[model samples]
Target: MNSSLTLRASAAALVLTAAMAPAVAAQPDDPAARSTIGVHARLLGEKIVPHKLSFQNTTVGGLSGVDRDPCSGEYVMISDDRSYLQPARFYTARIKVDAGGVHSVDFTGTHPFLQPDGSVYPPASAGDGKAVDPEELRVDPRTCRYWWAQEGDRPKSASEPVIQPSIQFADRSGAYRGQLRLPPQYEITMADRGIRRNKAVEAITFGAGSRVLTSAVEGPLIQDGPEPTVEHGALIRVTQQSRNGAVLGQFAYPLEKIFAESDPSSPWPPDTGVASILAFPGDPSRYLVLERTWVAGAGFKIRIYDATTRGATDVRRMDSLAGQRVVPMHKKLVADFADLGLSTVDNTEGMTWGPTLRNGERTLLLVSDDNFAEDEVTQIVALGIR
Candidate 1:
């Protein structure tokens, strides 16, 4: 849920202190520069964005994406409302941060995205193909225009129109600007031909200088394979394209095996996927990738991986990844949330580089999407990079 920049917060008395140690690495010789979010990381502090917070008629939750405007210094967050909670909109807010930690988050504005015809997007209940499931927001480093990712709809019963996912732009006031042309592979075709339902694009980012845009599919496509299971992990595609939509490259990203088994009797399916991605500052070839998973009884598992595309095969032409021999992106253990002592991880989905510390270190900021549930909270977690 990040693009332009990232946020950081604090206050151990009021927020959870995320004192996570470095996650265990597979390669014994893996250097931290290639393994963790930074050489060393520690808990800064955290604060909550009041549950069910409302802004301009929009429920300020389901915060799937966030990015700060370099010119304005204001952070923009996209809600995955699907036009249900308030016409598929976003919110602007100021999150105070420093060496001590994040002090406060004050939401300032809210705006709804306009359709090409100057209308608000309709809800999926209307069965229209225009409903949007906004996932991430990034400020166009060049134009300052809002670039966002929309994870399209997967028709539940064939009665609803299949909405192909897309990357689109909008002005600061939420006026429709334009959209990027997506590769054919992203089209919603069948159970084994294209993007999967609800498991399509979840994260997107503009590389340094806004030269390239990178996106991560939440899971394997129907043709790629099954979801990550306790027995083994899965493969998902990470696509890079020019702002105007020319395919630059596509790489395979191996997801980790499900960390825990779900309740055998639970009806809900276990889940695992990339929740957010941030391009390494000044380098598109490297990234800080976030992975989150949930089992029926085993809560949530979240981690940050220092990932690199160097030496990885560009699989843009590969038809399917199942049984393929291509080398995927290389990723190393970063930070695992299990090491943090928190009662509830709360469906954390967004990440960004936060304000720089007095020590010249950058703070890592995180936001959680409560999914508008009474039991959940809208949390903003801050960590220090040292």
Candidate 2:
């Protein structure tokens, strides 16, 4: 979550991605999560920005995706605003953190993303499925340009046009560069096929050694089956592709079950899905996968897993995986916010690597999408890792 989004109705946050760490001595004040294998991570600090903080005429919230800009040393955060409050855009931010704690998180600037026509995307009210819902975004370290994923609108009625999801490339200045070709599975036609709206491409990350950029749908395809239930999890495809959108490999990721029951009288239903994924900076086959589940009265349960494709099946050619024999990626729990004792973890999505500690341990940083809600918060948390 290149970057992340969230799924809270009040915030309407559908968080999309976190990751890196080095080993070192622990601090007495740090809260450590489960660490049986892979590596261990400890909380370093957390800082909350005012909800709906205003900046440059834009509401400074709904940050669904984030990445460290190797070119500017600033963190690039994408807001899933859908052009409601402003044009589709991303903001450059500076977050200073060390072993002791996070010193500060500052917004330096914001850039409006340009559509292919050299125009800003229209708002959802403009309809005809022309609005953009920008989710996870990343910097192509090689080109210093930006790559982003958006969960385009699925038609709510026959009067509404289908806005197919997209993965696109933009320059540092927010100009359109190009677009990656999406797989056919992304094409919607029937009622029970293709991607589910708001559930398409929520996670993306480039592999460690190869130019294989990987992307994942937030939930399952209509044909794949239903969403996660309390009794059983589900499956979503994570695609490995080239920058030009050439399909390289695709594997099924096993989504965990929703943690609790929803409120029968509540208007909103429960949900569980992939919030983000970060590839191991050094290992092409490994990643830190974050899964977030929301139960009506139970709130959000976020879990980071050490996932690998070492023995998973490539389902790029399969039409449906409902009952087929397939090996999904193997996963192990790395950390859980529920276990770390944070005051709250609402719609926490985007995450990236921060500065390495003096002890040689690398740090991981996370930011949340407050959905511009006054009760929610724009939060940034840091963790020390090895």
Which prediction has the highest lDDT against the true structure? 2
**In candidate 1, which residue ranges exceed 4 Å CA deviation?**
1-38
C-alpha lDDT (0 to 100) for residue 352 of candidate 2: 79
Encode model 2's per-residue lDDT on 1-386: one tens digit a residue.
11121111131221221111111111111112122226678888888887787888898899988888888888999998989999999999898888887789899999889988899988989975678889889888898899999988788788888888888999988999888899988766678788887788888887755388988889888877777666556778888888677888888887876777788878888766887888878777777787877777777777887777665678899888765556666666667887776778888888777777889998888878888777667788888878
- TM-scores for candidates 1 onward, in order: 0.89, 0.89
The sequence of per-residue lDDT tens digits that candidate 1 reaches over residues 195-309 is 8888888898888678999999988887777776666666788989997899999987767778777898899988779889988778778887889888888877778877777
C-alpha positional error of residue 344 in candidate 2 after TM-score superposition, expressed in Å: 1.3
- List per-candidate RMSD values in Å: 8.6, 9.4
Candidate 2 stretches greater than 4 Å from native: 1-37
Worst 10-residue lDDT window for candidate 2 reads 18-27
**Model 1 C-alpha lDDT versus the unseen true structure:** 0.77
